[model samples]
Target: MPDSGGLQSVEASQRPDSQVRVFALPPRDNAAATTIVDGFLEALTSDDPSYAVARKYLTPKAAKDWHPERQTLVLEDGPRPHSTDRANAEETGRNFELTGTQVARLDDEQAFQPDDRRYKGDLHLSLVATGKGKPKQWRIDTPPHGVVLGKTDFQRIYQSVNKYYYAVDSAAGSGAAGAQKRLVADPVFVRKWADPLTETVKEVLAGPTRWLNRVVTTSFPLKAALRDGTRSLAPDDANKLTVPLNKSADSIGAAQCRKMAAQLLYSLRDLSSSSVDEVELERADGRLMCTLKEGAADALVAPRYSEGTEYQYFLDAKSRVVRMPASGGAHPSPEPVAGPMGEGERRMRSLAISRDQERAASVSGDGRALFVASMVTNASLGDAIAHSGAKAEKDGFTTPSWDGQGDVWVADRDPKNRRLLVFGQGQADRMQEVRVDELSDDARIEAVKMSADGARIALLVTENGRTRLEIGRVERDHGVTDGDVEISVADLRRAAPEMEEVTAVSWAGGSRLVVVGRESGGLQQIRYVQCDGSTPTGQALPGLTRVSEIAASDTDLPLLAHSDDGIVRLPAGAAWQAVVKVGTAPVYPG
Candidate 1:
C-alpha cells in the first residue's frame, strides 16, 4: 500500500536491520506453473514497495492491472492451491483453485471488517515466450483481486496501533477552561516494518475508524496530508519529529496546531525502539506552525488512560465497599471508604467509582436498588437512585458503571423488564432507559464497562445460555430540559467473537480490555482483547482458575481479579499473586 509518506522501492538485500523485514525472491529461470504461482503468493507477503517483486511473476497485462492495496483477505489457514487439471501435463496453460476459510477483510480504508465464510478464488497461469529462442517461463495472468494471507502471516506483517482524537464536548462535559481534554483512542492495524510512523500519521489525518468517526474529532483539517513526496519519518538526535503538512494546514493557529501535535505525540507513543519526545508541525513551505514537547502535549490533551488511580475498591465479606491503595503492596491493609455505603446498614453487590474519584455508586446486595454516595464525605447511602423489579438477585441488576462524564449506567436483568438505564450528569433523578438498537430481542445484558472518554461502552450480553463481549457506542440527543434527553447505545458489535463465553470484562487501556472468557470446549482464561474485536496475538495471561471478576488500569497498575484463590494480581512480568483472601468484587477507579 502507498502511504501518504510516499513509499519508495528498495531491493531486499539492501534493507537495513532497523526493523523486522520480509524479503521474497523472484521466480527461478524457466520455473513451472505451480512453482510460479507459489513464488508469486509468497512474494505478496514480502515488504516490497508497490509489491514490485510479486508483480514480476505475473504477465505484463496482469502486472499493469493488479492493485495490491484495494483489499486484503485474511484466512484462517494460508491459501491452499489445488491443481485443476494435473493430468494434462502437455497443456500450455494451467488453472489452480485457491481456497481457505476467510476470517476477515481489510477494505481500501484499512479498517478491519470481521467476516466468516468459505473463500474460493482462481489462479490462472500460462507459458509465456521469452525473446530470441530463450526458454519459455511460466507466468500468472489471473489472481485474486486482493492479496491473501494466513492468520500467522497477517499478524507477522502488521501491528495494532492507536490513533488519538478528542471526545466531543457534549459527551465529556466541558470545564471552565474549555472542552474536557480527554482523547479517545481509535485502534487499527498497520504494516509494522513499512514506515509505521508515516502510515500512522496518515491514518490519523484520514480520521477515526468507522465505529469511532462520529464520536471523536480530529484536529487536522480534512484536506491535510503529508508534505508531497515525503517518505519515512524518524526522530532526530534529540528525539524530535518534524511533520510537514500540505497547504491545507498553512493557516492553522498556534493553539489548534498544538492540539494537532498532541494527537500525533500520543498516537506515536509506542513507536518501536524510538523515543519521540517532541513534535514540530511545519507548513508546506517549511515555516513552523507550532512545537509541542511531551510535557506540554499532556497539558493540551489528557490521555484517556494516562492518569494513575489512587485506590482499588471492592466489596468485602460483609458486603461493604472497601478499598486498598491501587499500588498497594502484596498485603496492603484494606479499609472502608468514608461514606455511608461503607458503614451503613445497607449492603452492596457491585459498585463503580467515578473517574474523578469523588463519587461512588453501588447496587444493593439483592441487586434491586442502585445508590449513589460521596466517597469524599461521610454521607448517607440515601434513597436508591434506581431500581430493578426482578424478584431474584441473579435476575436483577448487573454491575453499575460510570462514564467519564459522571453519568451512570446499569442493566436490569429482569426477563420481562430487561433494559439499560442511564443517570445523566446533574440529572440523577431523571433516569432514562437507554435503547440498545442492534441487540437481538432475546439477548440480555449481563455486565457493562464504560470507557473513560464517555464515548463507548463494553457489554457482556447473554443469549441462549452463552455470553459474549460486545462494544457499543453511547449516543445522546440532548434537549433543553433534562427530561427531554434521549440516550441509546448504537452499533453494538462483538469485540471477542472467538470466545464462546465471556464472564467478566474491564477496560485495560484506551482501546483495549481485559476479558475473562473461553473458547468453545476450552477452559476459562484471562486475555486482552481490542475494543475493535481484534485480538493481539500471544496476549493471553497466565492461567487462573474460576476467575469471576477482573480489573485493570490504563497506567502500570497491576491487573487484579477475583478468582478461586481469592483476590489475586498480576504485576508487569510477574505471576499472579495473592492480594486478599476474602475480597469478592475487585475494581479500580474508572
Candidate 2:
C-alpha cells in the first residue's frame, strides 16, 4: 500500500477533536539505545505501579529512584526520540525537544488536575550498556521524572478498584451485624505482575488512601498485612480466599472480623465467576472464623429493595410530591403524599426519597433551603438541614439525596463554596461540608444522585461553561455520641469526559448508570455507562427529547425523565411511554 495526500486529508478530517496518543512496545531481544528508551517510555504509559517490566529497560540504580506517580505528563501525541551518532552516544546522553499539548497532570500527591496547555520541553536521555561487549545491549541509566501516556491508553490501562468500607452509619431498625459498601475506587495500572484481587485486599488492609482517610474507615486491623504478603491470596478449590492475617489482628472481635471478610468479598465481587466466590478469614492461629459467600455479597454489604416492592414516587401537576405505582398502565394516576412539603410555600423545588420509603427530602420553593419530610401519613416536615451559603452567583441547593443509611447528601452550588454537604440523621443531625476545591476545575454541582448502595454519587457538574457527568466516591466518617460527620468526594474525574454537555445522571443498576448527554451529534440523548468510566453498548433511549432530569431506582422500575414534552418514561422491558402531561421531576425511594 502507498500513501496519498487526498486520502490523508479525508482521514484527518474524520479524526476526533480529542486525539489519544498510541503507545506500543517494540519487539527486540537485545536493546538498542533507542529501543531501551522506547521500552522505558512504553512502560511509563502502563498502569503498572512497581514498573517491573519497565525496570528491565533501566539500570539497577535508575529504576529505584524512578517515581512514575511523581508527575504525569499527558501528551496529545506519541513521544518521538532522535538518535545521535556521537562517539559517546551511550555515555554523554542525548537531548530532544518533546513538544505536545499537555492536557492534564497528576501531581506528586497523585491528584489529577487538568492543565490543557501546549507543553514544550527538552528531555534528556541517559543510557547504560548491558555488559562489556562490542554490540552491548543498552538500558536507560537516568529515567524520566514523570510518566507520559496518550489519553486513550491511559483510559484503557488504568482501572479503578473499589475497596469496601463500613457505611458512616447503619440503616435504622436493621439488625445486620456488619454492613459495608464499596467506598474507594482507587485507580491502579494493570500489569501482568499485579493481580487486582491481591492488590485490592492488600490495599484495604493497608488502610484507605490519604485523600479518603478522613472519611472512610476500614475494619482491617491497623497495620494489618497479609500473612504471606501478596502471595497469600491464592484461591482454593471453592473459589474462596482463605486470608490469614498477621498477628496484629489477633485481638479483633467477631463482628469486626465479618466486616473485614465482607470487605474482601465485595471488593472482589466481579472475580466471582473466575477466581473467587467467597472470602474466608483465618485467625492469627490458623483457625477459621467467617466465610462471606459470593451470592450474599450484595445483600450483606450493599443491600437494595426488591423490584416488586414499588415505591415509585414523582412530582404531580400541582408540583406536589406524590406516589405512583410501577404497575400503573398508560393512564395511571398519582396521589399526593402527606407532608408540609406537599402543601404550602414549602412546595418542592426538587425532591428525593430514602431507600426505606420512610422519608422524603426536598428543596424549598425558592431552592434556598433543604427540608426532609415523612413519606407516610402524620409526619411533619423535618428540620432545614442546610441554608444558602453562596457568595457569587445564583444561590441554591440541588435535590437532597438520601442514602440507605438515613444520611442526607446534597451539594450547594454556591460559587464561593462549591461544597458537597452530608448530614448524619439523629436527634440533632450533624453536618459536614466536603472539601472539593478543584472538583472539575471549580465546577458547581447542578444535579446529583446517591446510589442505592450508598457507595458512589453521580454528579451533573457545570465545568468550563459546559455540563459534564462525573462519578465521585462517597466517603463518610461519623461518631457515636454526637453523630459527628465528614464526607470527602474523591478527586474529580469525568465519567464521560469526551461528551460535550451532560445534563443529568441516575444509577440504573448496581454497577451501571443512565446519563443524558451528547458527544458530537443531534439532540441530547440518554445512554448507559459503567461506574468506573467505561461505556456500555446498551440501547439508546428512542424519541426522547432533551431531558431536564432523570430518575431511576433499585429494581426493574420504569426509567423516568422530566423532558419538555412532560414527564416521559421507558417502562421495564418495554418501549418509551409518556407517564404524565405535567411534571418537573420524577423520583423513587433511594
Candidate 3:
C-alpha cells in the first residue's frame, strides 16, 4: 500500500520574554524529516500526560538556541534538578549503585520497545550538540505498535487508523482516495453532516439562501444611493447590463437587466395615474338651447313697434298685425267714409288712438291678432289679415292687456264699472267683465296678463297705498274666476308697501307667472309665482323696472316680456344668456 500519512512543519522561535509559540509552514520535500520535526513538537505541547517525561531529553544550554519567528512558534528549555533521594544516598556511601551499572541502566531506558510502556511514549523536539553547532532534532523511540520501517508501512498504519476512526480508504484506492488520503493529517476537517452528501446537493440548497442574503444586505444601501444622492446603481450607457450579486456567490452579470427594470417601474406609475370617463353639451343650428334661458321653451322674437310709435291695429286671432275692421277711426280720416254713423258710433268714438306709443302689445298663437293697450287710448286692437294688410279697432277702454290663443284679456276702467275684459273674434260685443270685490274702493287694477293656455290670469291691483297680486282662473268667455287665489299679500308689503302697485304681469311656461311691481324707491322686483297655488316663488328682475308692458310665449317656454324700454326675453331658470333683447315686441308662437 502507498503511504497516506502527511507531515506539516511549523517553525517558531521564542521571544526575549520566554513564551512558547507555534505556527504552520509550507511542506518540505523530505517527508520523513518533516513528519519527525512536526510530530515531535506537536506531542511535546499536547495535553497528553505522557509528554511530561518526553521533555527531559532536551539540554538546557542547547534549548536556548530555539527562538520564535515573527509569525511562527518557539520552544524553550527549563532547569532540571536531581532527585533528593538519589543525592542523599550517594553522600552516605550506601553503595546502592555503581557507575557502570548506572550507565547500563540509562542505555536500557533509551532502548526501543514494542511492549514496554516507558519507551512507547510521545516524542519531543530538542537541540543537540553536533560537531560545530547545536542542530535541532527529534527524540522518538516507537509507539506500542512499533515503528513503521518505510513510507509504505507508515501509510498502511496511518490508513488503518483513519479507516477505523473516519471510515476513509487509504491512498491506494481510486475515486476520492488521493484527496481523502491527503486530508488524513490536515489541521482541519471539512465534511457535510446531513442529507446533502454530494457537492451538487450542497450547491443547490445554498443557492436561494445566498441570493436572499445578498438582497437583504444590498437593498437598503442601493435605495439610499439612488434616492438621496446622485449616485446610480445602473451603468451610464442605456444598453449596458449588469447582474447583482454578493461576495458569497459567483459574480452575476446580465445585459439589459437594469433597463428592463426601469421600464417596468415607469409603466406601473403611468397605469396608476390614468383616468376613465366621458363628457358633452347640447346645441341646435349654431345656437345653444336651454329650457331655463327664455321664460318659454321657444326662442323669443322682437316686438314690431318701437317706443313712442303709435300703431293702428292689434294682433288678430292668428297674432298677425291686423286691425278690427268694424271699429272706425275716432279722428276724421283724410279719406271720407261712405257709411253713416250710428248711435253706437258715439260710444265707440270715445275709444281714440292714444298719442303715447302702445305700451303693451301681444300676438295670438296663429299670428293673426295683436292686442294693444295704452293709458291714452285705453285699448286699440289690431289684426294682421295678410302679410301686409292690417286692421285696427277702437272699441273698448282698457290698459295693460295680453292676447292668448284667440282670446284677449285686458285691465280696463269703465265710468260705471271698473273690471277686467275678456274679448274674442265675434264676442267683442259680449266681452265679459271680472270684478274684484275684495279690493278697497280706492284700489284699482294696474296690469293684467292671461296665461298661454288662457286658463289662468294674473292681476296687478293697487289697494290701500299697497300693491297686491291677485291670481285667478279664467272661465270660458267670462273674465278671471274668483277664489282665494291671492299668491302673496305679505311679500307685496315687504317688497313695496307704499308703491306696492304691480307694474307688469306675464305668464311663464305652464302655470308659472312673473309679476313685476314698483317699490316706493322706484325699484322694480319681478315676483315669480306658480298659478298652481303653491308658495309664490319670486325673483327680482332689476333691468325690467317699472315694466309698462308684458307678453308670454305660446309654443315653447314663455319668455317674452314687453316694457316701456323695449321688447325683452326674461328666460326661464335665471340664465343670463337666454335673455334675447329684441328690437320689437315678440309675435307669440309665430
Candidate 4:
C-alpha cells in the first residue's frame, strides 16, 4: 500500500474527476509480512496520518515490528508533457538548469556483470515527447524483481507506528507515568537508599528519654522535694516551713522528716567526726539491767537482771542510761493462791470455745430430702436432726432419711439382703431393722426418693436397657418386702426406643417422673412417666443436646439441665434457656 505522497492519479474516461490508485507492494518471499506492512501503510491517509485506520489490519506482531524508526516514501514522476515548439522547449530547458548531478557511464570495453542478489539500488527515469499529433503517453512500470516490496520493511513500519500510539494512549489514559514523575520529585524518595545509617542516627538523637524524665519529675511532688528541698531539720520545724512545689501534704511531711534525719546523721558522722557505741547500765540493787546507744537516750530498753541481782542497766559511752532504771522501794505483797481446776471445770470452760465444723445439712422438702439419700455418718445425721430440734433417729446406720415426724429410715445396701432400719430421734441403739430381700436385688436399688407425704417411696433400678420404678408403701416393721414393693419394669426401648442411654432420672411433680436419655442422633429427650412405670404420657420435650445431668428444682416447675455448653433451665412446658454457664463441675443443692 502506497503512502499518501506516493499515491498515483489516473485520468478517468467516463467521469470528469481523476481516481487516485494506491498499489500495495508485495514482499519478495514473505506473504505474512507483505500483508501486514501493505495494510498498515495504506491506512496512513492524509486525513489520518496517525494510522488510526491502519491499526485495524495490523496484528500484534506487525505492530511490534514498526515501532522504532521514522519512515517516509519517495515518489518519482513517469512521463513529461509534450512541447509544441522546439525553440520554446530549448528556451524553457535553458531557463531551468538542474544542479548536483553525478553521472556513471558504462564503457563498451567492460563486460556486462550480473546483478548481485543482496545489493539494493534506486532507478531514476525521465520521458519526453518530440513530434506527434497527440503526444504519446509514456509510462514507466516497476519491474518484478528490481523494485519489489520488502516484507520486513513493511511489517517494521506498521509495528513501529502501532507501538508509538499504544504507548501514547497507555500513559495518557492511566496517568501512571505522571504519578511516577511526581514520586520521583521528592528528595526522600531519591535518597531513601543512601546513608540509611545516618537516618537511624538522626532518629536516635531525637529520642524522648530526657523529656519523659522531666515530665515524670515535674508531676511527682515527693520525689521533686526530696531531691531539691531543705535538709537537716526536725519534723515540727520542717512542718512550719513552706511546702515544696508539686508535693502532696502527706508525702511532703514524710519525705521532709526522712530527708532531715538522713542528712543530720550523715553530717554528724561525716562533718562532726562523731561515732556511736552501746553500753550496759547496772542498778544499785543489781536486779535490773538496761542497754542503749548514746544518741538515742530518749528510747529505753526493758530492765534485765543477771545472777539474781537486784538491778542492772545499760548506758552508752556518753553516760546516758538507755534502759529503764529500777526504783529504790519495797515490792508489793503477792495475791492469794488458787487450787488447780478439775476436768469438769475445764469442760465447763471448754463450752465457751467454738469448734469449726459443718453443723448440719437440711433440704426444704421431705421428698427432696429423701431423694438425696444420706450416706453420712450416724453422728452427723443425728446432729443434723438434733440441731433442727426435730425428732431425729440414727437407726444405728450411716445412711439415714428423716421422715416428716423426724423418724429416720436407714437402708443397708448389702446384696442378697435388704434391710430398712427405723429409729426414733437421738436413739442410735434402739432401731428396728426389717429385711426386704425378696422384692429386689439389693445392689439394683440405684436410687430412692420418698413421696411428698412420706407415706410412699419410689426406688429406681436400671437393668440393661430396662428401668424399674418400684412404688413401695412405708411400713413400720415389715418394710419394702416383695408384697409391699409394687415393681413395674419399663422397657425404655418401647417407651423411647430411639434413646441410646438414659442420662438422668428425677421425680418432678406428684407421680410424674422425668427420664432423660440420649438419642442415637446425639440429642437428649426428657420423657415423663407415671409412678406405675407406664409409657410416657406427653410428647417428648425436644431441642436438647448432650444432656450430662438433670436436677428438678424445688418448685418442680423448672428442670435444670447441665451440659457441656452450660446449664439450661427447661420450663415445664417451654423450651430450654441457658441460665448459667459453668466451666467446671457444678454443685446442685437438694
Cα lDDT computed for each candidate against the true fold: 0.83, 0.66, 0.29, 0.29
Model 3, position 501, has a per-residue lDDT of: 61
For model 3, the stretches where C-alpha displacement exceeds 4 angstroms are: 1-396, 399-405, 424-426, 434-441, 476-499, 518-522, 532-546, 554-558, 561-565, 570-590
TM-score of each: 0.92, 0.71, 0.28, 0.26
The candidate that wins on lDDT is: 1
Off by over 4 Å in 1: 1-20, 86-92, 129-136, 171-177, 303-306, 479-485
Of the candidates numbered 1 and 4, which has the greater TM-score value? Answer: 1
Minimum summed lDDT over a 10-residue window in model 4 is located at 160-169
Candidate 4 similarity to native, TM-score: 0.26
For model 3, how does the per-residue alpha-carbon lDDT over 430-516 read when each residue is reduced to its tens digit?
A: 354554434566666655555433334566666666656665434332125531122111111111222346665555444345556
Q: lDDT by residue for model 1 over 366-440, one digit each (tens)?
A: 889888888756576678887789988899888888887778888999988899988875246768888998898
In model 1, how large is the Cα lDDT of residue 198?
86
lDDT of 3 at 152: 19
lDDT of 2 at 508: 75
Q: Name the better of 1 and 3 by TM-score.
A: 1
Clashes of each: 0, 1, 57, 29
